[model samples]
Target: MAGNVTVDRTIVRAVTVFAMLNLLVTLNNTPSRSWMYPAGLGALGCVLLTLSVLASLRDCFRPVPTWRGIRVLTYISLGLMAAHCLTVRDLSPRDYPPLLHACGVIILTAAAAFPLPTGCVLMGTYAVGFFFVRLQSLTVGQALTECLVLLVSGATGLLLVALVRRTVSIVSTRSDLTQQEARATARALAQARERARWDGLVHDKILGALRNAAAGDSRRQASNAQTLAREALAAFRADTHSDAPTALARKLEQVADALGLECEIDIKQDQISSEVLDVLEAAAVEALTNVARHAGTPRVSVRAVIGQAAALLIISDRGRGFESQAPGQRAGLKTMKARMEAIGGQLDVRSTIGAGTAVTLSWSHEQPSWLTVLWDVRVFAPMIAIGAVDVILNVGLGLTRPARLFIPWLNPVLAAVVIGFNIAIAVCPRRPRLGWMLAACCVPLPAVSVLNLVTYGDAGWRYWAAGALTPAVGALSFRFRSSLGVSCCVASLLVLMVSEAILGRTSWAPVLGPFPVSLGVALVGGMLRRGLDGATAALSCENVRLAEQVRQAAGIAERNAEISRRRTALALDILPMLELIAGQGPLSVSEATECRLLEAAARDNLVAATLVNDAIAASARAARGRGAEVVFRCADNAQPHAGLRIFRSLVEQICATIGAGSSARFVWNGSGRDFIGTAVVLGHEASAIRAVVESVAHSGLLTVTCDEDSVLIQMRTH
Candidate 1:
């Protein structure tokens, strides 16, 4: 808190020092006198300086509250400066009054404390005082320029305060999120442990009592039953509330105890954020659930390590693993991965059939610096090529000059060096110091410009304009930090600034004037760099997320096709007998009853075969409505935990394509290294079946084999 407060007051302190020092400068430079008064104007100036110094000292510890007399003192001080300005006997059109500088500083200091509107008042007050003095004592142009510059300085002071306040707010917000996450985690972990304990108690005590009562059922067991009943009540009474473990090991141990898994907590760091730990722990639970439920009762191992840079959690089990992209498994992976991403972490799963499945979850506060410099250079190659060409062309033009600058071949040598650096950086840019490439781009112009100014008395503005190349390059490479970009550009400009004095010029406006533009370029670079950082992170997250979705859709489509084939088979078995009875003559009561019974039984089979997929349901309804025999069987699918929802739309498409006489068979082959769903369709010609296979096979998931009698689609669920 103290540090944040100090940061907020930095601008105020700086403005105070600026104001006080400029007052001293005024005392040294001003020539005004007050002989008629008991004390001269110089003595009065000293008194005012002493007061300002005292006020500054008080303000160092904390800002002066508005209720205090600081505002009034400041007003009085400005009034005194104005009085001094008015007393000046000689004023030149070209010279500015020293008091104007003092007024500017005082206004700047005021801006740091006051709200915007109040700061405006302070600025206006100072400007009015200075204006009153300047109107009588100096030329109109001098007065206007002083007022404008002073106002601009005051606005800059306000901007400093605003920036500081914003920084403090942003820091506070992040801290709050971290703290809140910790509290939320504590509550959730406590609840989970409490629930686990209750469950463990019931399983151990109450269920054991019931089993004991059931086992001893003879008359000799009545006393044993009574004893069991009493024991159950006693156990329930004794299972009182206890504190849930929250420290890392105890918490994880409790989880392992409840879940019946082996747990290891490797604490590399003394402390970890609860927010990060919560995310990791939750993801581990999801992974372990998948392993136990799908991995054929394999032994589960859970491990967690909290490190300095990041935390890692691993859950492994040797189980009968299915394809990682199998819809059921993919859904769990996606859920866990999304949880990790929310906390800026990565979640990954690796599995091979009959070997094992391992789910790894990791999170870090800072992004890992994973720079592919070659890729970055590839992206910027065109810009670098253009810059290289410009330098070469400039050198070619400079070669036409009959008179040499510094050396006979200096221009071409500098150009060659610059172009070499540009090409080298473009092909293989280095990470962490990418900004330094600007120095190479800067060298050609400044070296040639300075050499020309030395060799010839007349130097063109074109020579100075060439110096801007460094900043332009810096702007283009804004994503790089100071070491690689902005600082190097500024260094090149500083060389030109020093060169102007070495060339023996009285004024170095040509060199010094461009410094502000350099700063502007750096500002632009910083902003662009910041924006791209955010965009890069968001793009990466979206890429993996989209890949998961695409894999999921493919899995769903394959499942739906397989379900439709099952529905068709079930419909074939019963449909024709009903059709015969409807078309032919009247039947006996037994025949009619038998037909109704068969129809009812067929309808029940179809309902039981209905898949839990939305798209497959709609498609099945449409196919049946079109006089197609659809059969559904529970045996046609396996891997109940797999996340595939059989949508009817895919089946409808196939039925419509195959026409009215089609009979399909779906064989669910999940007892293997990968899930195999094969659909065999009859009544479609070999050519049509071949075409359908060609269209869906492009996905690299399904294989189609067609013969004269039937077409088979084998989809390998990945």
Candidate 2:
């Protein structure tokens, strides 16, 4: 309630200033002795208002007004004003110039200090009393009109302070929520980078050696590569460093830029280990370097996708590609394979003689980070309620000395019973029914323990019920869900306590006395039932989440199997054809061209199976056939977000707008919180692409920027 305090200070300061000016007037009129009595009372009122200013200021200089003392001081100022109003018939004491106005300011200031309803009662009652009490000296107009103005002005002032307080409180709450969101975003990014780092480690060390061995023409060279790969895997975990996905993203971008390569980098998650990040970074650098060397025009695209338990990175180039098996040309690919093998990941390479090249790295971790779980805050509500009830019991114990003296053993026996149940609750690995049963057993403990104490003293039956019902109310409310039940339980508890005190030591009979207590206890039993239902609801929600996860996992597994089947079918088609061409003597020029085309298409199709979404992949293939160079990336989501409908539609429009030999880039879900639901599409014909969308009925908001040479289309869904 910082906002409340701030408004309070402003009110106090205003009243204080008025008091100071009033004090000056009081001082000027002091020396006249004829009207000493009224003059003396007026002086005291002014002095009291001034003292309120000091107390309010002192409260500010120290800490806060958590106690009732500061409130009492403000009321004292109000009281002196009421007394002065009773004594003096006019606005101020005979010669004192309008001290009542200053008193009015203090009264309103006091009103602001209290809650509105209570403050209105206090300030209005005093203001009305003053006006009517002084009616003997006041005109009818003065009594009615002047009193009305005073009440209205005071209420308006209070309203203004409350408005300021409420506005500040809302803004303060929103700022805290914003900060929490920002921190959560940062952690997600960090974890994503960690996962990427582990994948990278596999690429750099183990995969690299395997690639070299695969390219070897001799058994000796192949055997040496095997030895290196094995050694790298054996020492891989020991040699790995903490992954920095941010560093990796930055370095990859730098590598592309240094080579004058035109590229876009989209990394949505930084959830890989440091070692994996390092490996992936090295691999990305190597792939980009390869683009600079063999791929003409040096154009590349790098993207990283991180998920619940797995991650993938795709480094692609649309420049002129080379044959993978060409002498000394497969060095980078060999190393990538070795690194992937080293860290228990996989690397797949695809290159076409003139089509393009794409390097795909895929990995999954056995244990996902706990931060990845989406936990509900309400999961701890029951625990918080239980703990709060426990603390309240302890506090009430200290507050209760008379009850303890009545039955000296009452305190220790109840404490031991409660503590014993506490231990029982703690020892259970899971939330057990026994714990709820034990708590139910402990709820009536106060009345039951005091059975023997009834004869010891005359604190009355009210005293015993006081000990019982206070705890009964708290314990019942701990988990009670029904508003009606809680109200009834509380009402019954109050009635039982009062009735017990009335009965004194009279009769334990009279069914009415124990009737309400029984109803209250039954209502408390509903707490146990409510808790059980809540637990059941939580379990059901958890089951839904797990079921969804399982379904997604199964979909991914089936897709992986489908991809394996496609690769096998494609290999069966290409390998036999290549083997026939090689054995049937040196291939003719046309035969060699056919072999290269078959290989490139096969490789591209296989890479396409894993690295890109079908929609984007189909659009890319279509655009390529139309002679436009397009790079499409969508990372972080195995299934495209619903928000991407507008984005994908706009991207297709852009790809369609590109003239033959033109180029464009499409990026979705970039690295910042603001950019998460955003997609950027930029191209030389961007303006023409914007024109294509000018007549379309788009669902989300689109921002189109047409530069001199490039048109840019940005879509934001959230």
Query: Which candidate number has the best TM-score?
Result: 1
| TM-score (all chains, Cα) for each model | 0.41, 0.36
Please identify model 2 stretches exceeding 4 Å from their true place.
1-39, 66-73, 90-97, 133-145, 160-195, 198-207, 217-288, 291-718
At residue 499, candidate 1 shows an lDDT of: 67
lDDT of each: 0.50, 0.50
- Model 2's alpha-carbon lDDT is 0.50
lDDT of 2 by residue, 1-718 (tens): 2334434444444444434444444444444422534646756655665675566656544433332334655576567666655565443312322344455545654576667787788677767765765465556654554465445445544553454445445544544454455455544443433333333433433343433343444554445445444544444324334334465667777667756788888876656665456566677777886787778866688898855367799989887877776422243465565566554578888888878988898888754211211112243334334443433444343335344345666556665665554444334333334434544554454444445353444332323333233333333333333333345344444443544455474443222222332333234334333433333344444444554455345434443444444335434444344334323433445444444444333333322222334465556556655666665443333234555566566656665667666777665663334443333444466567667767543654666666656665665545
Predicted candidate 1 versus true structure: per-residue lDDT over 1-718, tens digit per residue: 1234334344434445555555665555455423422346656655665576567657655753221234544665667666655675454343455445555566556565656787777787777767766666555764565465455545544553454455444544544454455455534444433333323333232332333333434433333334434543443334332233235556556645544565554544446655455555556655655664577763777777776467877777777766766532243454455456655688777888878788888887664322111235444444444444444444443454345455656656665655555455445444554435445556436645564644443232234334325334443345445344555555666666566667766334333233333343344344434433433443344443544454345434433443344335434533344333323344445444444344433332332333324344445445444444445433323444231332122343564555456665444444334644556777745477567556555557676777787777766666
Worst 10 residues of 1 by lDDT: 641-650
lDDT at 163, model 2: 47
